[model samples]
Target: MRSQQFLIFLLILKVNLKDVLLGFGNLKPGLKYSVLIFAVALPVMAYGSTLSDFSQYYPIWKPASDSTWNFILYESAIAIRMLATEFFYRGFLMWTLMEKMDERYANLIHSFVYMLMHIGKPPLEVPYSFIGGYVFAWVDLRSKSILPSFLIHFLGSLVFDLMIINQVFICL
Candidate 1:
């Protein structure tokens, strides 16, 4: 499991590197776009960190007894699960929806659906997910690429899952 997680992470890293290399000349423009992206992201992330119960919405601990192997397997499973989610939500869903409507409208609808997907989780998570969806959608729109959103989502999920597995956060 440890190997698998490491391998997946490496694969993502490689792809991102390739993209960076291919788009080196566009870095300045991309960074300019990312400014708006981060402007939207920062405040939400800051506010989210302040909630005492925010952690409850995430899975923060491993279900199995203490063991390195178990931890690796659990975390790896989480990474894989989140990767699939990114593919569905940010990749397929966003692309398909965008094709059917203007970017703004598509983003709004996509964010709403993304929030709906979290309905069964913690009550707080419902709102959080909605906000997160909007932020991610904005990033996608501004960057004109899904890569930025995917990176953010992947990292966020990693931290959320690690917090859950470590018992730093409890699920509702």
Candidate 2:
């Protein structure tokens, strides 16, 4: 669902996959900055699930059984979903906004829209989504690619799921 805009843009612009995934010329700054961005986000992700009752919202821990293959598949699906989300937000929306306006305004608009999309999420998450969205947009704009934000978002989601699984199922 989230990837529809990205797909439509790709069709209209006839943009290539590599350029869309990596962004245009001069990729070094984005690449260099990704390490710092991920490092800073690591600890936040470590404690993310503890911030709210995400399990009540997602109910994913019910399937955290000893089935390795099932767990792998679940995580894989999450990764794909997160990727699609990042592409939609940081890739399609951000870049399209940048084309029409200044980068800072684009980031703000993108962050607001991103936060709005989190309206049905855990209560605490809805407000914080704006901050996280802005930060992710900054990283995407700096790196000129959604890959960095995608990595952070995907790993953060994975960590949140793992933490919930560990607390609800494993630790029980």
Candidate 3:
């Protein structure tokens, strides 16, 4: 049987993917903003990753083997989760709460929830996620697509993972 992580990833993948495709696809519009937000956030996340002891808390799945398939499967799951997370925060939330109420409130609510998700994480990251989440939500609000937000979330997370691993391996 697939592990619990894979199962959760599957569920998220199905729901979030459907929402993005059905709700507000046509990703062309958000592509430019995605690149811009990602580029803008990359360096900051990189710097923050270095400052925080992220390696201690992340990459939950360790290498089972050095085989290519092992890395592919692991990273692919990570990528899926990143996409799913952003879709929920930036896409689903935007459609639901933002549609019902003003977008500013929706963004704040999303950011607060996003921040809460980081509670067990490093102290710095907890607050950072809220602020960063707001920025991404705002970007989505402006761009009218979650594409840019997804790109930023995924790339930012991947970069942090890389930084954490790099710091560990370099020191050893």
Candidate 4:
């Protein structure tokens, strides 16, 4: 099981890197602005952190020493995982499925799977992902790339993580 996993891991990494390079090369100013404007809603993003806190899951452990190397490794793993998710859902799910079906229908199917993937987490997040998944899919379609979605997903989760850390830190 572990040996086969490496090949899949490498395949996914290659695909994501290819899309990222191409997506960055072809990126437009409008998408940049959309992300910038979207970022103004950090407080709204904190809602998920609130739910996490209520569920008593706040404050993922940090590096004991705040070492730069530790931070890089930790954040890089998260970024890679987040990018993999965006590529799978926004890139492959939207682009690949659109070939065999209507775009709207493809997005709907993608949304269903996206939400289903969120199962076993907090219940509130399940429905939220359904709605957010469609929006991310639509954005990927319009932007013609998964880069924006990756940025949004990555930074949005970062914000939530920071929110939880801040709350925990302040209390301590």
What is candidate 2's local distance difference test score? 0.72
Those runs of model 3 whose alpha carbons end farther than 4 Å from true positions after fitting are 1-29, 64-69, 167-172
| C-alpha RMSD of each candidate structure in angstroms | 8.1, 3.4, 5.4, 4.8
lDDT of 3 at 94: 61
**In model 3, what is the error at residue 10, expressed in angstroms?**
16
Evaluate all candidate structures by whole-model CA lDDT and list the values in order.
0.58, 0.72, 0.68, 0.65
Clash pairs of candidate 3?
34-148
> Compared with the true structure, what per-residue lDDT tens digits does model 2 show for residues 52-78?
567565535446445556666878887
TM-score, model 3 to reference: 0.71
Of the candidates numbered 2 and 4, which has the greater lDDT value? 2
Count of clashes, each model:
7, 1, 1, 0
What is the per-residue lDDT of model 1 for residues 6-102, given as tens digits with 9 covering 90 to 100? 4476477564422222123324444555556556656665565456555555445535325556656766776666655655565556666766888
In candidate 4, list every pair of residues with a backbone clash. none
TM-score of each: 0.59, 0.78, 0.71, 0.72
Query: In candidate 2, which residue ranges exceed 4 Å CA deviation?
Result: 1-9, 16-35, 46-48, 59-61, 64-66, 167-172
Ranking by lDDT: 2, 3, 4, 1
